[model samples]
Target chain A: MVPVDYYIILSAVLFTIGALGVLIRRNPLIIFMSIELMLNAANLAFVAFSRMYDSFNGQIFVFFVIAVAAAEVAVGLALIVEIFKTKKNINIDEMNSLKG
Target chain B: MTQTDFYTILPLTVLAVWACLLLLADLFIPKDRKGITAFLSALGLAVTLGLTITQVGRENLGFNNMVVVDGFSTFINIILLASSLFGVALAYGYIKRMGLERGEYYTLMLFSVTGMMLMAQAADLIIVFLALELLSIPLYVLAAFARPNLQSEEAGVKYFLLGAFSTGFVVYGTALIYGATGTTSLGGIFFAASNGTPGLLLTIGAALLLVGFGFKVAAVPFHMWTPDVYQGSPTAVTAFMSSGAKIAGFAALLRVFASAFPSISVDITAVIWVLAALTMIVGNITAISQTNIKRMLAYSSIAHAGYILMAFVPYGNKEVMPVSVAAGLFYLVSYAVTNFGAWAVVISLEKAEGKGLEISDFAGLAKKYPALAIAMTVFMLSFIGFPPTLGLVGKFYLFRAVIAGGYTGLALIGVVTSLVSAYYYLRVVINMYMREGDPTIEREQWLDFTTVTTAVATVALSFVPQWLFFMASTAALRLF
Candidate 1:
């Protein structure tokens, strides 16, 4: 019987935290995790909103978002592993060989 | 799905099935014979193009109104297929020369093209999100396809990080929109907005959606990832991303805003106006400082996005909506052709390990190869919106539409920024003809053919733009 506003507020806060992690994190691994956090936060909001609207569409979208996140993680992990092989580091700060 | 639903997405179905088949077929193909994959990819695109062509002039909704088959999607699909064909052709030569030939490249590009086609057809928010991911994930892989190349890896990481961030924004926005209106369908949202004043949640949701799409189209403020990503990725991949992503992003933007949020047009138009103006100024002004050809073109592409956004500044006006949208579509087509041609020239001049990409490398191109230089000149002129080029006609339509909507100031800003753009676009020409440095270019027949064809089309179509414009206007009419 939790209020929906509380759920929305919680979701927004979690989303902001995830976005901040993405901005502040330098490790690619952590950045990928942050992106997953952001996606999960959106999923939470989607499910909550679905409950409020009494519609199954939002829940269906969440299922798809989960699938997409898994695909993204697969690609992200592959990229991280590739970069790790060459540079011996996954820190974004040191990854800047390409510049003007 | 019903038979009618299947028919509505026939072209996309064809493309998706072919791309999947090509992905598996690529595994058995030898590396030395990867050209077969590229050739087959182009053939598939051509077949899909023919299929899409047959569906023109029809307007219907299928999949419970989750997908639309209309003039708009058809026109955009035709442009997407043509651009992808050019992408495959350009990649064929560049990849071979760089020793980066792989069947996977063509397969991934076909998948990306399929995503773009689906994006144009999507009528529901969930479909839009799916389409965006479908298009973007493959691009991330392709950007890094030049694995072991440090810069390519960097480009892939940057693009993937920012791209996922933007996708998060889109999903959250969709959630908010569904919460506010209780429906995710564009038509349903329109009915809701028409019935009553929109709530705060709806407005915020729409703004978030803009931020998401703004990143995709590389509009200013959300364009931080573009320069590095475009410059670091392989030139052919950059070319496809710039044109293909921009066309699809704008299609979705126009569809969502013009159709779904018409009632809140006044509020959103102001936001669009500011975004367009800033994108023009920043995209053009920044290009002047870039020495790398790919980086300069990246900024130029961003500035072009600003001009396209001008068409949406009038989206709220029912009277001018169709004209403005049609003008935007025509501009996309012109920009795609001119951009691919320009990149073809760049691909020819570039060497492995990213040497000879500086603007200075273009010096003396005219003396070395007159035909190539002239083709480059045509692309430069078109980018600068000079006469006898499709860029000019596209601009004329855009400005006319905006002026008709009473946004003369926005039109004026567009003109001024284009003038500013001439300084850099023509700088390449000046570097080629006016300066003197020996430039070495690879002898690639496919690249040369694409460059010449696009350059000629840029000029030839300008002289007879009526037919294309007519098609665009008809397409725009269906959105209402």
Candidate 2:
């Protein structure tokens, strides 16, 4: 069996990449995907830790996180559709109408 | 869940059910009769408030200790319900006037309040995460409630994106904490920390949690989304988010830190002290330049978060935790009442399609509506922490608690920034009385009533604050 440290490191790396994608991406679609990646990374870490600790709590938490991520994706896509309908673009940079 | 668990969460359960019922009832009701939903929502909140009041001072752990019923949660719940009532009242006029009236507006607000109430009662990290989402998802929708409007849509997307990012931080942090401590319960974490020095993973996790909460409360460095979201959302939604979501955020913050991380406070307190100072300086200084009233208040709200964070800076001190926490709670109540009142006045003066919201639009308000002008002046006075208003007493307690906790330097920063805040808060007063313009009002009876009552209460309550102060202190005592 694989060691838990390897899984945790992979999860942390994935989380960092996802966070960077969110920071660097201009498209709302990609940003949403990045957020999903981040959530899944947390899910991965939870699963890894659960196995190491022989505890079901972390696994249960992962299930809840997955469920929440699905809901978040649904809402995020709906908002993106709403924005695209009016502005005809999904770029965050172009969606700056409410400024100081 | 047992019968005891159901009873422990009676108010939250009632509110959630009522909100869903309102959503279904809206489908059958005609478009012209949306006011019924608002009235029904307010009635539900009033009943839930009563239920919550009955449970006050009765501490219980239910749902296997995932939920807590105690003085702290009850006090915060009362503030949440009262703020929602004002939110609905203010929304009634603003939504109708702007032709944005929808039953979902009230329903979503009720749902959001339920989330907030749940946050106050959350005893586990998982519950905190769930409650955060429950509170926020509705707000993201409410921010974009004025759909087809480009600004509103933009606000919704921005808030959603950044808000989701913050949630990621919270989740990852929770995972790390669980990794370090092997438990997600607050009590479990406390036991783990008290046993030995927490590992690097736990400290990093705690920092990430602070970042997540800092974003929620609009503290500086994470406040980039606040002004835009507040300015673009419907004024009523903005009002609710500013007061309700903020109080919930602080409730979760205070509870988690006080209970779960007392042993780790030395490290986190330094980070919090800097956050408090930076938020106060940036929030106040930036608010001075905003012409948009919504944006100005957004910054003011951020500055107020800094003041509340001042109380948390001394959380490590065993002797001062209760006083500091109580001061933070009292300040939240004072800010909620005065903020809702200020926003009510703004809602009354707001025109269709979000016009007439500029600070200059308030010119000559005194000449047009003497009563409104006086109310706005009182709100402004409260925001500036002037004497004879609740804001002054709240700030006095906050500063005193900070000083008692031996964070006198942070307290000095609070005082100076508050003094700096006076220039902007009073600027609204100056615009209302000293300048001249044809300012008009929407003439909504509900909104006017909210404004007048909150204003009067803001002043009247200051004279007899002992009861509220005692209640808040007792609430904080339970946590300690």
Off by over 4 Å in 2: none
Q: lDDT per residue, candidate 1, B260-288, as tens digits?
A: 99888878999999999999999999999
Q: Tell me chain A's TM-score in each of the predictions.
A: 0.98, 0.97
Q: Write the per-residue lDDT of candidate 2 for residues B259-301, one digit (tens) a residue.
A: 9999889899999999999999999999999999999999999
**Could you report the DockQ of all the candidates, in the order they appear?**
0.79, 0.87
State TM-scores per candidate.
Answer: 0.99, 0.99
Give, for candidate 1 chain B, the lowest lDDT window spanning 10 residues: B440-449
Residue pairs that clash (backbone atoms under 3 angstroms), model 1: none
Model 2: lDDT of residue B333: 95
Which docking category, incorrect, acceptable, medium or high, applies to candidate 1? medium
lDDT of each: 0.93, 0.93
